[model samples]
Target chain A: MEKLTIIKVGGKIVEEADTLNQLLDNFSALPGYKLLVHGGGRSATKLAAQLGIESQMVNGRRITDAETLKVVTMVYGGLVNKNIVAGLQAKGVNAIGLTGADLNVIRSVKRPVKDVDYGFVGDVEAVNGEMLASLIHQNIVPVMAPLTHDGKGNMLNTNADTIAGETAKALAKLFDVTLVYCFEKKGVLRDADDDDSVIPVITPELFRQYVVEGVIQGGMIPKLENSFSAVEAGVSRVIITLASAINQDAGTVIKK
Target chain B: MEKLTIIKVGGKIVEEADTLNQLLDNFSALPGYKLLVHGGGRSATKLAAQLGIESQMVNGRRITDAETLKVVTMVYGGLVNKNIVAGLQAKGVNAIGLTGADLNVIRSVKRPVKDVDYGFVGDVEAVNGEMLASLIHQNIVPVMAPLTHDGKGNMLNTNADTIAGETAKALAKLFDVTLVYCFEKKGVLRDADDDDSVIPVITPELFRQYVVEGVIQGGMIPKLENSFSAVEAGVSRVIITLASAINQDAGTVIKK
Candidate 1:
């Protein structure tokens, strides 16, 4: 099977001009088949504030109301996604921007109201690996926005990490997929404040040990869980690192 | 040569939910290879007003400053384009939404300041018909937004009609292309006041004669001029009709 790299980038790397360009340079230089999944929460929040729409948050996660959904669609799908595509094109990479709804590549269900109503947020129900593989086979790199649709024509806000993991899992049948989560941090650290305290490799047992040791707490816990899930689902590897370290072999590797 | 239809829809039809759904239904039902180019001037204007940004217009044409360009990028590329893609997907058409920057499908140079600065507006330099043909051959329907990129990583506001016309002319080498300009009017009318005054067929000679007799005046003249140019550029036919008249044969056809 051909090897494919799937990178999920956080909003900070993509929100600014300088970092985005640097990130794109590394991304464009990456060898082999690649797909990019990106988040634009910062930009969306700024735009929403400018438009006088109040953004509601519960437990540090945005409640995607109808208006907030519009803002995210514009920022994540339009501004941020197109800029990345254009930047990659300037570097001689043929990149195509997409939302999950574009080819029905990802269909998600609206998050049902339990104790909290998340408005138009979606939990992905399916990812069309066949369509994605066809695009990859044609040498077209897809830059996907963190948005999905409920097959009935409603677009929903989705998590970028989940998108990358699910997409990697789906494409595992056709390719040896490597899912990378890129953010501001160097990698999972022993000391959260120290940049060089990067753990080289982590297995399922070690991940549990770290959790019990309080080294990997808070948001990183769920992130690792998702990564392990991908590995269990047949994805070959998963990496967590800074955006600039994409080409460098300097990140925490997740192994089954 | 295989036949391809390129439709350019007006902003009004897309702004309203009912008309947009109807338009998407008609568009999805069209046979063979097809592409959609759409305008979102109305949405852009509305968004600008919301963001407290002044929309500058010189003689009814938008003067796209930096701020206005951002609004259009969001509205046209994000809101309008994504909705069309999702709608087509729901109807079982594999549609991919794009701006000119995506895959570098279209490259434009910034319009030099002559009389008006027109801040970030672009005059299209080239369209990559080969790339477009490849996608169409793969049975993927492209839904293009009215935004172009200046090869150096800048997104410029472009006219949707020009995008449609230029794309059709470029694709003429690979396909027998039909360019349709769909608006509120049925066709080129003998009298602007009467909805029933549809002109069946128009030739270059008749177009000039009608202009001399004041039968075709104002905005319609330039529109007809563009239609003639497309015909001259090897487009098999150019149709001017209402959005609902897309599938029907009832519209004015421009012939060489």
Candidate 2:
């Protein structure tokens, strides 16, 4: 199987001109088949505020009302995604910007209201990995936006991390998949206060141990859980790293 | 050669749900390989206003200053384009939305400063028809947005009519291409004021005579000229028609 690197970048690195340029530069230099899954939450929030639409978040998870979904669709699917595609094109990468809706690549069901209705949020049910693998085989790099669709005619706001994990798990059948989750920190740190204390490798056991030790509490818990799930679900590896160091081997590598 | 239909729909039809559904229904029922190029000028303008950005139009052509360009990118590339893709997907047509920047399908040069600096407007220069025809052959319908790139990291506002025409001409080399321009009117009319006055068939000589007789004045002139140019450039036929009447053979057909 051919090697495929799926990098999931967050909003902060891609929303600004300088960081985007640098990120693209680094991304463009990667070898073999590559796919990018990107999030534009900050841009969406900023645009929503500009348009006088209030963004609601519960437990740090966005409550995607109809208007909020539109903001994300515009920001993630439109502005940020296209910019990345255009930037990669300028550097000679044959990049295609896509939401999960494009080509019916990923289909999701709308989140059924539990405690709160996530108006237009989608929980991905399936990913057409064969379709994506076919595109990658043709040397077309996919720059994905964190947006999905209900089989019915509706675009849904989706989490980028989930997209990356789901896509990686699907494509793992066809390729040697490495899913990279980029964040502000270098890696999962041993000491929360010390940014330089990067944990080089983590296994399923280490993950549980870290949580029990209170070293990997808070949001990092779920991120690593997804990473472990992806790896166990057939993805060869999952790395949590800084966006700038994607090409470098300087991140917490999750192993099964 | 296999048949290919390229339809260019303007903003007015697509910006609304009722008309968009009607148009999509008409489009999805069409036979053979099909592509759609769409404009979202109205949506872009509305979004700009909502964002507190002033839209400038010089002689009815938008002056795409920086802020306006961002609005268009969000509206055209994001909101309008994704909605169309998702709509088509719901109708069981595997559609992928694209800007020219995607796959480097179209490359344009920024309109140079003439009497008017049109900001980030682009003039169509090249179309990668081979690549597009391949996608069509694979049963992938491309829903194109009215956006192009300069091959230098910038998305430029482009005319959907030109995108449709250029794509048709390029694909004509590989397929029996029919380019359809959908407007408010049924087709090129003998009487500009009469909705039922569709000419049905128009040759270059007839077009010239219509212009001489003042029947083809105003914006209709450039539109017909472009249709004629597409025919001359190798497009098999060019049809000017209403969006609702796409599947029906009820439009003025341009021939060599």
Candidate 3:
């Protein structure tokens, strides 16, 4: 059974208490065939501002300077992780929120930048699928946050999409499930303004064409890249869709 | 295979970082099996004071009023939990910190006082052995903190020792391990002042005899009670010893 659905949830999708609860409810009713990876970028940025600290971003990823790293670690791995775990458990989802730091489930090498070395941000190097599959096999849904550690014992800020991709590939190698990428938008679209123009399917060539034609750019770039990575890494199928479309079948499917 | 070990660590264990690190380094390397259950009572008390809130205690248990509950939950379950997890992981120990609120591993029943209601303090009613054994079997140490919730979704302040006892009982039903209740004292003794007079062993009858004779009084009473409870629940053995003796074989072993 080498199949799994890796679902990546964006912070915006979980902004309100009701939305988070509703999402968990939909997830609980899901066919017990998916794993979830979550992002908390907006929440971390907002909290850092409230705490009077400036968050630095290089490209779309956070530049984890010491101060910013601490805030994000505490918020992403601690506060938001637990809240999501509690929320899903409240909805009878049997969710366990874990960080890459736990069980050394995900490991990485720390990336230091000019003068300002990020005290604890690492680029993920490995994913421990055995540990994760054991939990999922026992009927527990994992709610993973975007954080990993250097194998040498330092924490790091990682891209949630990348984490989800790696996790999808890992789970795909381990079980039979689906990989779902959930965001605020209503799936991939041919026309950005028309929500009804959802792309039903995508191929690697179509993806490149869409990017060059300006139909898929910005956030969609990394997501598509992640989807392609998962597909390449043995995940049989990948879904790029909206959270609202979880119970429906309106998301774009990427498969061989 | 009804064997179990319950190790109780105090909040002061983390307050003294160097000493705590040394202890963790030694404890993590111990040859036999073990599980660590910890208390953050002192931190909860201190944070409650700093917040200008009145702290309440009943029979040495912190009465978890709403404000105090919030402080303890954030400090113990968040900061303290992560600190220990980080420390253990740093030492190459695969320690996973869990709250009773997570996975419903340790469930409780709210025990509000007759006259004055303690907002969220509970007495242990159940322990999910299947969930625990799965983790332990995978070689991941379960580092439990005493913040649980009733199944109805309300949080509760549970006694750390009680949680440890229930956990030991659960593990005892699945594996052969000793339950060591470590604290500040060298060991339970006939006389309080003589550290050298550490009681080597005691049976259920002898423990009762000591209590009736006014030998085991005050703080030792609850610990002894927890020990006896674990013994009755099929744990292979119980020991009341100091944290410093974790690496050493110096402790009072309580047997069936």
Candidate 4:
């Protein structure tokens, strides 16, 4: 199997002009048969504020109401995804921007109301790995937006981390997939305030110990869970690091 | 040769909910291989207004300044394009939404300053017919947004009609192509006030006679010019009609 690296970037890395340029520069450089899955949460929130729509959040996750879904669709699928694609194309990468709705790449179920009705939020159901792998085989790099569909004519807001994990797992059968989750931090830091205290690796044993120790809490928890899940599903490795240092391999590597 | 119908619908039909749903229904029913190129000018303008950016137009053509370009990217590439893709998916069309930049499907040069600087507008230079036809061959319908890219990392606002015409021309060699231009009216009206006065078949001689008769003037001239150009480029036919009536064949058909 050939090597395929799936990079999942956050809103901070892609939303600003300077960071985005740097991200594009770094991303275009480190690659062979790579795909990008991106978040546009900050941009979506900003656009929603501009459009006078209030963004609701439960815990730290956004509640994707009807209007919020439209905002995210515009920001993530349209603005951010296309910018990355054009930038990659300028660098001679044949990049295609996509939402899960396009080509039915991913079909997701709208999150059912358990305690909170996350209106238009979708929990991913399936990823069309063959269709996606075909594009990679054609040398067309897909830049995915954090959006999915219910397959019944509705767009749903989905998590970029989950999108990346699901896609990586799906494509793992045909490729030596390395899933990279990029955030603002360098890696999973031993000391949250100290960037240099990067934990080089984390296993299931370490994950539990850290969770109990209050070092692995909040948003980092779900991210780590996704990383672990991907590795278990035949993905070669899962890296957590800063978007700027993707090629450097200076990040937390998750092992089963 | 495989027959392919390329339909171009303006913002009026696609920007509204009811009209868009109707369009997806009728469009899905069109026989054989097909592609859709759409405009989102109204939606873009509305978004621009919401974002506190003013849309500038000279001679009824939008001047896509930096801010306006962002608006169009969000509206045309994101919101309208994805909506169409999702709707078609529900209708079993297996649609994939694309912009010119995607897969390098269309490449355009920025329009040089002739009289006024049309900021980021693109003049269609080439279309990758082989790449696009491959998508269609795989039974995926392409929903194209009215946007292109300069090879230099910039997304340029393009005319939907030109995209359709150019794509139709490019694909003509591999497919028997019929280019359809859908606007608000039924067709090229013989009488401006009478929607029933649609000229069923418009030959060059009749077009010249109508121009002299002052029946066809202003915007309709360029649209007809585009229709004629597509026909001459080996497209089997060009249909000018309403979006709702695409399957009914109740429109002006352009011929040599």
lDDT of 4 by residue, B1-119 (tens): 99999999999898889999999999999999999999999989888988899888887779999988888999999999999999999999899999999988899999999989999
**What range of 10 consecutive residues in model 3 chain B has the weakest lDDT sum?**
B1-10
**Candidate 3 regions off by >4 Å?**
A41-74, A90-92, A114-116, B41-74, B90-92, B153-155, B189-197, B202-215
| Better structure of 1 and 3 per DockQ | 1
- Candidate 1 Cα errors over 4 Å, as ranges: none
Would you list the rank order by DockQ, best first?
2, 4, 1, 3
What overall lDDT, based on C-alpha atoms, would model 3 receive against the true structure? 0.75
- Please give, for residues B1-256, the per-residue lDDT of candidate 3 as tens digits: 6334557787788646776776678778776556788877776776567557778886677777775665666566655666677677778889777877677787788885688676678888889988888777777888887877676645678888788788878777788758887767788888888887889998888988998999889978877887878888888888778887877888899898
Better of 2 and 4 by TM-score: 2
Tens-digit lDDT string for candidate 1 (B1-256): 9999999998898889999999999999999999999999999999999989888887666899888888888898899898888888888888999899998999999999989888888899999999999889989999999999998888999999999999999999899999999968899999999989999999998998998999999989889899999999999999999999899998899989
TM-scores vs. true structure, each candidate: 0.98, 0.99, 0.86, 0.97
TM-score of chain B of each: 0.98, 0.98, 0.93, 0.97
Better model by TM-score, 1 or 3? 1
Better structure of 2 and 3 per lDDT: 2
Backbone clash total, candidate 3: 18
The whole-model lDDT of each prediction reads 0.92, 0.92, 0.75, 0.92
lDDT of 4 by residue, A1-256 (tens): 9999999998988888999899888989986899999998898888999899998888667998878888998999898988888888999999999899999999999998998888899999999999999999998899999999989999999988889999999999999999998867889999999989999999999999999999889878887887888999999999988888998968899988
Best by TM-score: 2
Clashes of each: 0, 0, 18, 0
Categorize the docking of model 4.
high
What fraction of the real A-B contacts shows up in model 4? 0.84
